[model samples]
Target: MLRMEILKLIRNNVVALIIAYILAMSIGINILSFGFDELAWVERWLPILTIFYVVILIDLLFWMAAMQISEDMETNMIQVMRTSRNVIQYFFSKHVLLLLFILVAAFLGIIPMADQFGFVLNFLYVTLVFSVVMIASGVLLAMIVKKQSVVMLAGSVVTGFIFAVMVRLVFPLWNISPIPFNPFEAFIKAYYYLYLPVEPPNQSYVALTLIAVLFYIISLYVFKKLTFDRGFRL
Candidate 1:
């Protein structure tokens, strides 16, 4: 049943899914080239990770959710499901599918640059946690905003704010310690700042993973409580 539901979503959103991959990869490559050259060796990793998460992963997932799920709502399919089957399964199934899609897409973007950055496993772990958080945020927004345009707008704003906090505020402050910054150190810092990915020592990776998990639980609870009406309803 879960596989069938996932296949249905992929079939329905094939076009948007293709576009999302193209846009994410293009942006990832371009940023990798331009951003790395500008920063000193010491400073490049955080900036790259921040751009990958904030600009690409977070932004794309939100847009993908709005483009895909919002269409079903507009056509009243979601409303019909409320009366017939398990709404919780439907909601969670979509989230799982989206999370899976993001994990694959992130691999495609990060694998090529693995050698230049570091080990594939480290990059994969960071990308996976970052993707999970973005998916959780997008799913949570989708539950509330039924209209396509509104969902798109609200998701963008919400993601933008989260990025602002993570990259602009939390990370910079966390990285200011006089201690030398290395990739390993950066990873540890990120773990400590887990709420923001811009911090070093990848402590932020831990933060992102924990945050995504919490948001997923809250989103599941909210989805279970939502009563979808039989007719076209928001």
Candidate 2:
């Protein structure tokens, strides 16, 4: 199942899009980063890199997740395969695929910034947890939504809300010591302490890590219950 999925990924435009996404982000963001005065001197580039552009990646990831499952549901492939194989394992293969995709994409995406910051393990750690949350969120959205287009839209909306909340964009005046469960927002601290000698409190990491686990459990439960009959669409 996993091998077949890998073949599908390689044969499709998803791989190309990931490369494009990373390249566009790396170059376009450098231009955008300069619009703000003293972006590097003030250490503000990381936040802009993370919050400003991540929605595009989120949309791509959600679309990938939805396309993987929704296309199967839209056709008879899943139905035909269910007779011989565990369909749940088939879906799980997609989950693993998305995990690997994000890790690689994120690791490569950091290359431009790595010249100054070098490679930071915490960046990968934050990305690892973020990918887990994103995969789980994408899977859960796939389970609930039956159409590729519809699921993509809905997943973006759901993830956008979560992203807003996590970074305190929803309530800047909340005056909270620690923010809500968020992974993408950790991009700054993940590098600062290691590269710039600026120590981080790490309060957000602890909180976001907890939610990442909870989201995974919930996604697996819903994914296990996923069924074609339950999402029958003409």
Question: Top TM-score: which candidate number?
Answer: 2
TM-score of each: 0.60, 0.67
lDDT of 1 by residue, 114-225 (tens): 5655444555565556555566566567667766678757865655554444454345756644333221233223423433345344234556567657766775566546
Residue 56 CA displacement from its true place in model 2, Å: 3.8
| Weakest ten-residue segment in model 2 by summed lDDT | 187-196
Error of 2 at 134 (Å): 1.5
Model 2 residue 212 CA deviation (Å) reads: 1.9
lDDT of 1 at 65: 56
